[model samples]
Target: MNFSLQQPLENESVKLVPLKNNDFDALYQVASDKDIWMQHPNKDRWKKEVFQLFFEGAIQSKGAFKIIDKSSNEIVGCTRFYDYQESDKSILIGYTFYATKHWGTGLNPSVKKLMMDYIFQFVNRILLHVGAGNLRSQIAVGRLGATKIAEESVAYYGEASKLNFIYEIKKEDYLSVS
Candidate 1:
């Protein structure tokens, strides 16, 4: 079977559904908080126009998801599975952000665990690109046992390139982590 990035993924805490055009308002509700983007590479993404472009790119990726809080049944964040490298047998999981209210909770890892559990079935490695200055995300990925392998320039879908730290986790390593 072909690897499908937008497939519905869920665990006890959250559900990741394939993003759709109509999901704009709901997702924007979660993303509009300036604090949500404070540590993100695109800090002003909370604005309507900027987020519109970001949302547009997400739609085009065909791999984006609107994350939902299972208990509240409300949109809480967004993430994606992108840049699948066939030759290297790897896929990237990134463009992730969660509502500030969810921060410091176990939601991030819970969400990542669900994604890793699903994606590891199809690839040997998973990669993440975090903004160089985004300490929050860097620490989160580190907790997942991903090592910072390199620093490189990563251009957003339609935006300029920015410095990013590439973190990688091998399937064997992730599996061995308790």
Candidate 2:
């Protein structure tokens, strides 16, 4: 239970830091853009109220982070690991969003690598839930070598939505890849 919780994970390609107060302006700028949240479960489309609510939740949960570009020192996106069920020895990694520019590049792979590497240090398994309709995310999860386990309608943002696929990777499997 004494897990070392820290922020701002950095590697050669990207930096994953806690979403702090200073990130408000930058996060709000990108999060407020309608195009960013189009495929997201939260249909609010990053509106002011939605962003506020999201940030508040993130702060309270203490499980999210802002993705920063080390070279340019710019905020490129956000990702997090939440809903930790210690009794089940499982945790969920979602609420990820990256700027259009960061998409398609190896940035995501590198970020995920860092997160998974860190997470497996203490947990036995990790779960990723992707919207079924989001092919991009689905493929990403598959590329991570996670096996799809099930699908269900879960409440996200504010409503009960269907087509959420749950993918899981055990510690042994993760070690094989890492």
Candidate 3:
């Protein structure tokens, strides 16, 4: 079977549903808080117009998910699985952001865990691109046993290229850790 990037994924705390055009408002509600994007590469994403472009790209990618808080049944953030390479059995997990209210509550790791656990079954290596200036994301990926492999300019969809740190987690290593 072909790997399905937008498959519905869930755990006890959160559920990840394929993002749709209708999800724009609910997602923007959480994304509108300036603090959520303060440390992100695209700091102006809090603005409606800027975020609209981001949302459009997410829909186009067809791999993006609107994260929901299971308890409150509210949209909490967004993430995606992109740049999958079948020959190399590798894929990228990124473009992730969350509401400030969810930060430091162990939600990031929980979300990552769900994504990693699901995707690793199809790919041997999972890659992440963290903005060079985004220290918070760097540390978070590290805690997942991912090591920075290199740094390069990454042009986010509908955004200018920015320096990013490439991190990689091999399937063997991840399995060993878990």
State each model's C-alpha RMSD to the native.
1.0, 1.8, 0.9
> Once superposed on the true structure, which residue ranges of model 1 sit more than 4 Å away at CA?
none
Error of 1 at 141 (Å): 0.5
Per-residue alpha-carbon lDDT of candidate 3 for residues 74-159, written as tens digits (9 for 90 to 100)? 99999999989999999999989998888899999999999989999999999999989999999999998999999999998889
The 0-to-1 C-alpha lDDT of every candidate, in the order given, reads 0.92, 0.80, 0.93
Which rank order by TM-score, best down to worst? 3, 1, 2
Comparing 2 with 3 on TM-score, the higher-scoring candidate is: 3
Query: What's the true lDDT of residue 65 in model 3?
Result: 98
Per-residue lDDT over 1-178 for candidate 2, one digit per residue giving the tens place of the 0 to 100 score: 5564344688997889888767777988778777777776675757887788777767666878998888899888888888777897788888788887778888788888889888888788999988877778889889988899999877665445657899998989989877
Per-residue lDDT, model 1, residue 171, is 97
Model 3 Cα RMSD, 1 decimal = 0.9
Leading candidate by lDDT = 3
Instruction: List runs of model 3 lying over 4 Å from the truth.
Output: none
What digit string (tens of lDDT, one per residue) describes model 1 on residues 10-85?
9988999999999999999988999988878889999999999899989998889999999999999999999888
Residue 176 Cα positional deviation in candidate 1, in Å, after optimal superposition:
1.5
Residue 24 accuracy (lDDT) in model 3 = 91
